[model samples]
Target: MIRIPTLRHVATRSLRCAARGAVQQRRWAQVHDVRFLTTQPSQAILEKYREKLSKKASQEGHGSIDDLKAAYSEKIQEQRKKDSTEGTPVSQPNAPSSFPPSKPAPKKASSSGEKPAIKPLGDILDLEKVAELPEKELTAIWRLRHASSPQTLCAVIPAPAYQAMESLARSNPYFVLPVPHESQGAEMHFMQWTFDPASKTSTVLFTQLAEYKARGEFAQPHTTVTHHLDLIKDKGLVLMQGQVMEGRNVQPDHAKWLVMCLQRFYGGWEQKGDELDGQRKERAEERQKLLEWFTNGDPRFSVEKLLEEAERMG
Candidate 1:
């Protein structure tokens, strides 16, 4: 219902904020997959905007959003050209559209001879086992599972799709999502993705603008939620983690709700998504073509191995 995929370009995420610093009558709420904490740490949101300038856009624009984007886009293209010229095998970039990585360690690959083949993600991966896979294996599995799923923002994207995402992210870096369920607290949230090239990780920030000024003398937006995303070492598996920054009497249910909303957001994009019959038909046709291609022994995806992995794990 949140339609988070509407701003699917950079895979924008929720934010974690610092709740303890405030003397006002507000509390903090944090949400993450593997961990939870009540003491609000301002690390997430503040870190993202640390580089933001306070003045009008500069022509020289050192550290300007547009400048940073142009530089990154050029660098991305350069990397692609380098890969092509040097005959580099396609892999996930060091910084995938500016995302990060983290989470529980995945299972170490075990030696097995007669493992079953891997299946599509819709077949339902053992989220637990999958979570424990080594970064490289996890990334490979992510690609194998979701490579052709329409509208997903995944690592190992096609050149064209990656370019499109870059264009969208650079041109419009943030998304303002209207939240009906959260309207009583805040009408809309300002969501942005901070891609850190230095650390090769990305952070998603969700800020709820306080309708009125804060209770303190210096007024500020009431809520800030932050999430950190990372790509597995080389294969580029994504790790989605978050912590809530502000709220009152927040319960564990709130964290669950936030996670579900984010999961749905990454599931789709565009208004129609894959809802229409025509779109579904087209998707099915394309998938069939891929199946045919793989059936004939396409080397792109180690289909057999993936199937083996899927079957072994599932």
Candidate 2:
């Protein structure tokens, strides 16, 4: 004989069916509340891979994982540049790329989506017609010139700074040459300068004299560090520069010396300029007060009127 189902069994069977249907319906739409269930690699997984990469980089002669990554990025950049330049794909002998071949990776950008900076243009110098450029255009040309060889510019100090330093240096008949990180004990130094108004060029001689009658092996420029300054008056710019006479037999720390000397001169020049400006301002203010005092504090009368009255009385 067939048996009838109890009331509790019937309710339980309905609940089970409902749960199965819910699971089926919500499979794709379910929120991933668990941390590790996301598609992207977790922090721990990334760190684990980074460590493995570091080891591989060491074996492959890279200084660090960062170095390896930089080299790889450089190679890719070079490849892209080659393709862009030659209009053809070139086979690279370098190691294969880390990314999957099936999908092309997206270009990397800054958070603001700024375009990547291209390699700077170098080995270009055009002085002709550079003078006719307006101030803004001239500044552009200056930037390009500086960018091409920034290291060379460290040795180039402003003309104003050199003039200010020259005035101070002349106070002493003979002084020690200022070399960064070195001392010239008992040895004297001096400068001899000549200017040509026509060419607007100043030739400065930075001479080093050895100790009186106390001699060891003496090296040139015993008196030979020469600097040439060319003034561009029309553009309100000075093309002053100091250069070694020769490439050989120079100071071991020549680069450092140039940098330090430039720093000192620039600082002194700025300070002197500020002082001179302050003095002029103070004098003008005093002259204005004197005029006001004479005019019984009238706003209408100015220093010009006072001078005019004095000239009329004479």
TM-score top scorer: 2
| TM value for model 2 | 0.31
Quote the positional error of residue 37 for candidate 1 in Å: 31
Estimate every model's Cα lDDT from 0 to 1: 0.32, 0.34
Candidate 2 Cα RMSD (Å): 33.8
> What are the per-residue Cα lDDT tens digits for candidate 2 across 32-62?
1111111222344336578897888999999
For model 2 the local lDDT of residue 25 reads 23
Model 1, position 287, has a per-residue lDDT of: 33
Which stretches in model 2 have alpha-carbon errors above 4 Å? 1-128, 134-175, 180-190, 211-232, 245-248, 252-268, 275-314
- lDDT per residue for candidate 1 within 1-314, as digits (tens), equals 33322221111122212224333322212111111111223344434554552232354455564454454554443332222112112233442432223232333232543221211121233445654566676556555433342222234332332333333444334433333222122133334444545333344444442321121111122222222122233323333323343343333333334334332232222222335577645544443333333334344423222222212211
Return the clash pairs for model 2, or none.
none
